[model samples]
Target: MKKVNQFASSKHILALAAIAAGIALPPQAVMASQITHVVQQAGAVKGTVVDSKGEPIIGATIKVKGDAKNGTITDLDGNFTLNVKPGTEIEISYIGYKNQVVKAGSSPIKVMMQDDSQSLNEVVVVGFGTQKKVNLTGSVGLATSKDIESRPVGSAVQALQGVVPGLNIDTGNYGGDLNASKSISIRGTGTLDSNQSKGDPLILIDGMEGDLNAINPQDIESISVLKDAAASSIYGSRAPFGVILVTTKSGKAGRVQVNYNTNLRWNTPLNMPDMMNSHQYATFFDQAEFNGSGNHLYGDEERKKIWDYMTGASDVFVEEGSGGKWNYDHTYANIDWLNQYFKHNSFSQEHNASISGGSDKVTFYASGNYLSQGGFLRYGTDNSERFNFTGKINAKLSKYVTVGYNARWTRKNYSRPTTVTGDNFYSHVLRRARPVRAMYDPNGYLMSDINYIDAL
Candidate 1:
């Protein structure tokens, strides 16, 4: 036992003698032997670093802090196996990719990275956030209001036609439906029924939910189409069809100035329908006779009287004594049924005025518009009337507070028409009738229900 104690004492003496001689150990050794210490921690989560194409970049240089033990290159396939404590910061860089710095999250990470080429050019809007467009891996379409300003459409939504590659605007039946546009689909027909499947894209007006038609073409700024799932996932199920982001004009940082604009427009039909001939009408009438769904029927003499009355050929047949042809007159000849519904000329007048100014604390713009239109169709039916007003205000109350206000009102009306000829009412003063139609007695009343057509 005494010998063992003497050996331990000799080793302690040797260690002390060596330390006193200024013999220094490695870094870790330098700190513990009555020395101060410096250490670095890893902030990165393992396997989170990925390439711009979303593929792992093997052998990529990865380092966090000055700790050599915490720094290493990625493995083959761009995959990295790393271990970092929470709050650690890791910077990953590759030969062809941009350097990425990421802090360790509570759980594992799945980082979607971009290459140097795209990292600098691409961008993505994640959550309520936005990144470079070149950085995104999903599909999307974007355009400016100028791209569609040249076309004449009732609603602003229709302006998107052809701007986005995936969208389709179908034939519209609601003639001059100025308040709304034709149907639009971004992801193709979603269901078996093409008519029903072409749902509208979720439209956002200046960050708010609303119809696109409410804004005038002059007020639009930009439009972005979220066509892919990832590009629209942030909106959830509300975006099953797709999403349309619309940005409106806002006040800019400049001296206050008032602006004025005026517009005058004239419209003419691009196509005209074929006219009906008296001989054909006389023949086809008997062949394709509506047979009048009603019990009323007019005989040839009555038809002749009515036709004469319509043409003003025979001192005008009176309803009482006129056993005349109801629609045989040449007046039907001059009446182009197709063109009858529309006007020979339409006039549209528009005017707008606004003032905007702002500074470091606040900026705002206000504008008003007036529009008048005279329709082509007859009044009390198939007519048009509209008057609208809108106001908006935006202000920054303080360093941390902001507010905005908006209001709009519109008064509108449409006329209706009644016709026994059904669609023929659109343009024609004539209707095809069965030979039996002439049998109906006068008084514009049907002798048999067979000659009248149901109202569409």
Candidate 2:
């Protein structure tokens, strides 16, 4: 009993010492102190964000200075509420604006954000949406109107020939055909030859599967080429090779604006094959024939005649046939088939006009394009003409709903003489037409050959 009393007395002495040192408190008093601290931490901070112009900036972000998880965006009225401790710092930020940090001491705070001096980031169109270029991933090539507008090309695909990397544009045998379509591919033919590969990229204009040649180059606002499989997953099999997304220009909220652009261009063959003259042709032919059959196709007399004709020493170009008809002297001609059939220069022109306007509720954009191109043929009528028209309208019905309508029209016309093959006139001209043949007889009459007739 004495030992238990001695222990109780020691506990009392310790409590007295703690009270004298001001370190001991009652249980109820300690609970009250903790409750008061919890109440102070529960205080809410309300704030409104605005621009330097005093305009409410909706969607602005407000968060505790160092707490990314505790953040909220401003409402439509630029108001935000966040619960934070007294004297805690809060941050406000928005795109294209400078960030602001302030202390949370009072019930309401006003933050006026300043405009950031740096330029805004470029927005790139992705599979089914848009994203900033800095935030985009995967392989993509972007081209704007400035890259293609000034180019003198009939097809938009032609304008992008060397503009984008890994994008292959080929005119091939149809390079001289004014209205001919060009083939487009990406990343080459892969493991297969070009003739056997079906690797054409999918081209989309304003979300519609349209021909790239049909749309006017001037009407295009931007082109996004998605090259990787991950970037084009939304298109599925349609984009097995790649995807080309084209976005057209839209009206902005401003006064009515009109623009007109036109260009005239001349085209000339850069390098043509240096074909053999009559003398060289005879020498080579005789050598080839002798080498193959051990006999010359042309005798010495024929060689002499070819040399004389090439030297312009003989004017005998035609002779009378037995049936009272004139025949071109086959041995008295040395014609340059390429120079005789193709022009040195061709003329082409394009004109474009556009109008755009908008208000807060309604906006519209309309454009027209006209193109006329002439072929390289020196004879016969070879011409192509194209017209394009596009119009779009957008209306805001309410804060949440928007409606839009788009329309496009195009027309093309091309005229040329019949050829031995289907639209392969240039190749036939280069292959079938011989250098010894003349386009016209001595009497200025059309040649009797079917090739000459068809070419005319």
Query: Which one wins on TM-score?
Result: 2
lDDT of 2: 0.79
TM-score of each: 0.55, 0.70
In order, the Cα lDDT scores of the candidates are 0.56, 0.79
Clashes of 2: 0
Supply the TM-score for candidate 1. Answer: 0.55
Cα deviation of 195, candidate 1, in Å: 8.7
Per residue, candidate 1 scores C-alpha lDDT tens digits across 157-180 of: 667777778987764664453322
Error of 2 at 66 (Å): 44
Looking at candidate 1, what is the lDDT of residue 236?
Answer: 88
